[model samples]
Target chain A: MNDFLFRLFRNGETRLHELNYLFWECTTRCNLHCRHCGSDCTMGSRDKDMPLEDFLGALDTIPESHRPKGFTVVLTGGEPLLRPDITTIGREIKKRGFGWSMVSNGYFYDEKMHHLLMGAGMGALTISLDGLEDSHDWMRGHAGSFQRTVRAIKTASAQRGLNFDVVTCVNKRNIRELEEIHSTLESLGTPQWRLFTIIPIGRAASDPDMILSKEEMTRLMEFIALKRKNPSGKMVTTFSCEGYLGKWESQVRDTPFFCHAGINIASVLIDGRINACPNIDRDAFSEGNIYSDNFYEVWMNGFKRFRDRDWAKRGICTQCKQFRNCLGGGMHNWHGACEEPLTCHYSLLNAE
Target chain B: MKFFRNILKGAALTTALFVFQACYGTGPDFDPGIEMSFHVVSKQTGEAIPDITIMTRGGSESKWFEVGKTDSQGFAKIYGLDYKHNGIDFKFEGKGVTPKDTLINDFSKNFHEIRL
Candidate 1:
């Protein structure tokens, strides 16, 4: 059967069951310009930062029935700490009966911010740590960032119930330094660690050195598999759920490959546009605007493109035997410029 | 007679399995997209201005992409430009007016109404 007919008869991944996670792009301003930053956030970003009330007002638009129990709003941005009112935002989010967390580079985060945020109902944090000093500084395009981030990690990890996870963006430059980075994280008393390879977009799209080749990708997977198998420190390490990795799926990550963008996860961009995932291209897949449309209505009925996978089965995806299992990789992996999916773990492994 | 009965049962079982698989099949998951719109008006008379060109850039040295131009109603919009810099510079120019520049430093609001 054809793609449309098949989808019509079958219950596919396009269905929105419940809202478990929501990412709010609070701001687009960051202190550093990372080489592989998908959002290309810089210190001089011109995007206006949303006020605490704006996000709260947008949250009110999502009816309680649409969200699952204990739903959390994840605040992500150029750097969430750039906003002076982050604590107030967290407090307001808590007032609405939802938990809150943040994704940060750990540059400005310290003991004081952690205390303030925790008091304001911050439950978790995911901080980026690309590599050891030199490699990390180079990737971030800033000096002394690694030291500041490491200090923040230590502070966060020392606290109980902070649920800190140190995420590293693996690239050609840092691929060799994974072992050292892991050791550094373990020493910092990190509770969890995640590994993700760069998607070729933004600054990364222009820099060929930022993306890993098939062989290098295998090495990264093998390294993760080894870490998972070996008795490491107290830290629980897993590869990020960025794409399907065939045999490495169960070994590297806690669960099998799944792109939870629209179904269970959604994000509001700085410009008031709602999308399934933060990394997804806003031009092609925006569901609706928080300013003009009701959030619950958009969540329920507006993700037509997100819920359908029939169109993604073109190009190299059609040739892969794992297409049915991988579903053309993650939506973020689709390079609109090239009109083909990039970084297929299945295809990469098969190439070997 | 017994052999014919077995063949019918086998075919029925195959059809049932196919139907079950068809209804409960799995595939790839969710995605996203967004856009920002703008409106320009006269500062002196509060009249909607037309033919205004809105050029956007991430920073001082970043390349500029013409997001959109104001129409007869002074409305324009932008989406899917591959630039990722958060800080943006919106420069407005028209046939017979002083060029103006505005800064939206973060991903805050989508709709902007500017009076030139």
Candidate 2:
């Protein structure tokens, strides 16, 4: 009995030795094309669906030992749900005993679709909602996307089995509506909310005006401070106060965690391509085809490239103090190179 | 000699198990029923104002409670509030001041104050 117990504990520790995460871009096709979207995701894109065989083959390559204990697979896309075989992909992931999560625009929710996904062991569904009805619709470039998203949230929330979270991208257009968006979420009773800063790339590059200015970010942080002080704050807690504070450059220096991505978290693309993090693109780092190569080989080769200081030679990423923490400034925002360090207006406001 | 080595290994393992269990067992021993007093004051006048209401939200149950009025000095003390965490928010209101507004939130020590 003593020998058996000792081996069991030892094996458990050894199983969790490697830090791993997978981001599966099931499709690049999106229903709504938002103005500030860094991906430039649109309904017209030809390369939409990822072949199911390729996806499953990629999963088979990840050895059971190196597979993380609570192995997290994030299914993202132009819109992952738009793919025909998303539910099948979800089921396959669950069969391998891995946790499944998704990032969607929330326009594809229906009674049948919701049940299929929840049945497939979908752990969490993160939906995008830019602002209140008019503001959100305008930002998404669809007249009724806001209403559809609200209905989808209501539908998803009504389904007791489904876990849903709302993600709002803060930019110049909808910066003022932060409080209103919070109130809307409160009214809907959504459990979790995440506020992400916009990365400049794709359409965002053409319209520099869309990006949030330094002054706006400062005001937004002040409002968040006030909300924290409020006793009746109804915002559902998904992330910690410390986590939110680190998003600001001024507070980031004090935070102990330099980069949680590529170590604790990672992003896998649809074409058997894997990235070190979700916020980066596949072309940035294609270590090897996931179908042909094992995770160990790909991870080691890709991680070296990811950790490369060539960004310093490029002159954009090297000079920035927040480089260690920022982790290549979110993959979608990588637009070749500009003279600037791709600093978010929010960080610049607090920058010394 | 083999039997003796196995016995030594077992003893070391037992000691490590006990140490792990002890570390996990030691945690905060909090009394849920115990309540404390909260005070609110104006930063400008340093005078305790009357008709300010305070409430607690988020937890098992949401409860609303009234605090005391200020004396000569701008200080009102409200009691019988239990908090699981140190940081608790209190909303304050007066005739001229904004109603349903957050007053006190930061709680480093036991005695917490809201300066409007």
Please give, for residues A1-352, the per-residue lDDT of candidate 2 as tens digits.
2334543433332232234346777777788878877667778776747687777776777778666444667777788888877766765676675667677788877544554455455666677888888889888999988888897776565543344567777778787887888887877777656565665666877876576666776776666555555624555422111122335433322112223334334455656666655445456555666666675566644565344434533345555565544434433344344334455432465466
Highest-scoring model, TM-score: 1
Runs of candidate 2 exceeding 4 Å displacement: A1-17, A158-163, A231-234, A237-258, A307-340, A344-347, B1-116
TM-score against native, each model:
0.72, 0.64
* DockQ for the candidates, in order: 0.01, 0.01
Q: What is the Cα-based TM-score of model 2?
A: 0.64
Model 1 clashing-pair count: 18
For model 2, how does the per-residue alpha-carbon lDDT over B2-112 read when each residue is reduced to its tens digit? Answer: 354335436954433211100001101111112334456667787666555444332223343333333344443332223333455565666676555553444444465
TM-score of chain B of each: 0.61, 0.42
DockQ, candidate 2, comes to: 0.01
lDDT of 2 at A10: 32
- Predictions in order: lDDT: 0.72, 0.55
Instruction: Kindly report which residue stretches of model 1 are placed more than 4 angstroms away from their true locations once superposed.
Output: A1-16, B1-116
